[model samples]
Target: MSSPPLPLPHLALIGAGITSLTLSLRLTSLGIPHTIYEQSPSLTELGAGLGFGPNAARALEYIDPRLVEIFNQTATFVGTPSPQGKELLLQEGKAGDDKIWIEFLDGTKQPEEGEELKPEFVIRAGNNKGHAAVHRGAWLDVLGGLVDTRERVRFGKRVVDVVLPAGSKGRVKILLADGTEAEADGVVGCDGVKSKVRQVLMEALGEGREKGKCGYSGKYAYRCLVPWGKAVEAVGEDRAGVSSLWMGPNRHLLTFPVDKQDEKFLNLVAFVTDESQVWPERGPASLTLPATKADALGDFEQAGFSDSVLQLLKVTNEKMDKWGLYDVADRPLSKFYSGRIMVIGDAAHASTPHHGSGAGFCMEDIAVLGALFEEAIARQRLTVDALEDVFAAFDNQRRERDQWLVNSSRRAADLYQWRIPEFLKPNSLEKMKADIEQRQEFCWGFNVGAAVREAKKHMSERLAAYK
Candidate 1:
């Protein structure tokens, strides 16, 4: 039997970051026409390296097998090389669940005492190789190239609002910052963490305009790269290539290599979690400001961080980027879509980098949404009412897991700091491994194929209601 035609020939996509570009692949593949409206003057990503595991790797492969090839050839650097898939999963998390080598710095005991600082005990690690770490911009570039989305992507169209268009039954109107507007049969917002599209969706749900605004996660990151030779010089030839984590009372530093020559350097993010540390960008705006190496070194001193880790820090690239981290958990939401507008990626759920799965989850969102859209276009059931069903399916399938990411990431931060209810015994090596394995299952074991199939099954039932 011939499939139903898509209800509309043209669709609107807001924000052309990684999520939008990835989604564009699916839409383009199914012959579903979409135009990406990006607020940025150009399509690029600014950040340090990111990891993607099997679940997200499979989703990218599903998006387009070539994307994986491109990512592997260009972006897969550092971390373990999985037989099937791998990606960076988190910065650092859990009390007894750390993936990299743990080193106890000066005065491993609590900070309240005036005792002399010295190393107490350390758990020998650095053998676990279990994901891919790619520079953020290089990874985005690979995705952008493989997805073939540039032609349809329109940059500099800042989205101000997304709402149901007047007199355009079930269609959506995207208000631009320049005061012009564009209407489409439906809007798929692959926007970002501070998404205007999400606000619109929340507003429609009567959750108030500011109901689920993004907020700081009480963590800021100082990230930089170290030239490969210099890093190898400091950390030794063998240790420099793997994941190395240095831990202290309240701060930790992670080091990993970047295989791609584009960033052929050692990528490390030094995270400081001091109660007294206030965000310099105290407004609603989140800043990824330029950080001096001196400022980062000061943070190390403030945290009373050890010199063992400082050796790796001193050899880093001249550039550093500091930013306050935010997540969607603060301003909780009850739903994922409204009317013809559906939010995906950071637009819908922004989790902390503690999990390293935010973008992976975004890929999962694209996998489900794209599958349903493919089915809709094939079944000739694409329509206003039908899209609502699709959006509902997306929400039903994705909300719980995606929201879990937000909470889990926050929980991970506590676990990593040993601030949780559970206590780590003396030299708890096996216990740490066990805790890490238990907590990591959800991330590493998530089957994108199974998710796509299940969403399609649920979507089939929902589409019947509209018919």
Candidate 2:
């Protein structure tokens, strides 16, 4: 066969997070030219754990099967019957063994002495029964290792501004914090929630800088990676090994295991909502404010959490840091792209962790963008207009689904914390169960392949208009 067309429109990827790395892998597979710009001095990601639903896993497979393989190699699959299967076999839980996504319990009540606590409801695992999870740093290292090289990823080059092309034929200019400039045919903002490229894109779209800022969801969490042995010692192995959620009034705690080559740990996030308190500005001190172990115990104690749950919290650091959850719900962008600059991943639609699907959604974004760029190369449309068409098509096909995640995530927070008004009515348990089941199915049942085909069709129509 003849050689494939050379990749068109040299691209600049802002931020070297998962979004950038995943997209880099896809572009590399297609021989596209691109660079990852990160503000950090090195490739290090700080977070406790990252979880992926089946939909997210499918997105990885769609981008490249190797991605799924890499993920499976490093991730911990909780309560999965078969780790390497394509079909999810739904089965009821058995004593000492649970086969479910999460067992939701009433955190506000403690079981009577000698009484076994029963789950209010359970959400069966989606496809493959693989609730794949891993430490943020571990997976970041793996992904970064695959894509990061001195020539491909540039560090300490924080983006200060993105100057959009004045005409369809000109290049987009990127200004860095170190007083340097780089030009590319297009810029994809894969930066996190505090993305400067997003700010620049917002201003270019005539939306004020405030439009790009992430808003606090009135929730804060205490995150820790406790040793798996310690968790098993505190709670029995059966309970500790399985993923679960303890739901209470205005608070909820989630736990899952993350196993790597060297160690296995339990990832825990205890969320509390205090609308009365105003979120402090972003800074080291504000982001991870110190709190005594007593403070953590106090928060869960009043909620009537069992000794097993409290012991898990106690196994954490004597002094815990409170991490406020923030998202783009308050000021969602009217448009995802302005000229040749488009925002993707968290930079586009950061959401609360209530849904635990943010990272998966990022992969989905990469899959769609990858398909569009492949189409662009095949068509040999190398002009700025063609790139614009690609961005427009991406925005048209992706904006609705992504923005819905942000909204639904907030709604899920309410449901988990018993803050929804419907919880006060009769049959509240039934309503909550139905809502959770429906949402989980919807989130995990997305069709990434169909999305790719539709987006390609849309991009082709847009490209034909320019012709």
Q: What digit string (tens of lDDT, one per residue) describes model 2 on residues 426-467?
A: 768878888887887677777777878877777677666776
- Which residue pairs in candidate 2 collide? none
For candidate 1, the per-residue lDDT at 185 reads 79
Model 1: per-residue Cα lDDT at residue 16: 86
lDDT of 1 at 112: 43
| Model 1 error, position 256 (Å) | 1.2
Cα deviation at 437, candidate 2, in Å, is 1.2
User: Model 1, residue 240: displacement in angstroms?
Assistant: 1.6
Which tens-of-lDDT digit does each residue in 302-397 have in candidate 1?
666655466677776566778777788878668888767888898899888766678989988998888887777656777665777788889999
lDDT of 1: 0.70
RMSD of each: 5.5, 3.5
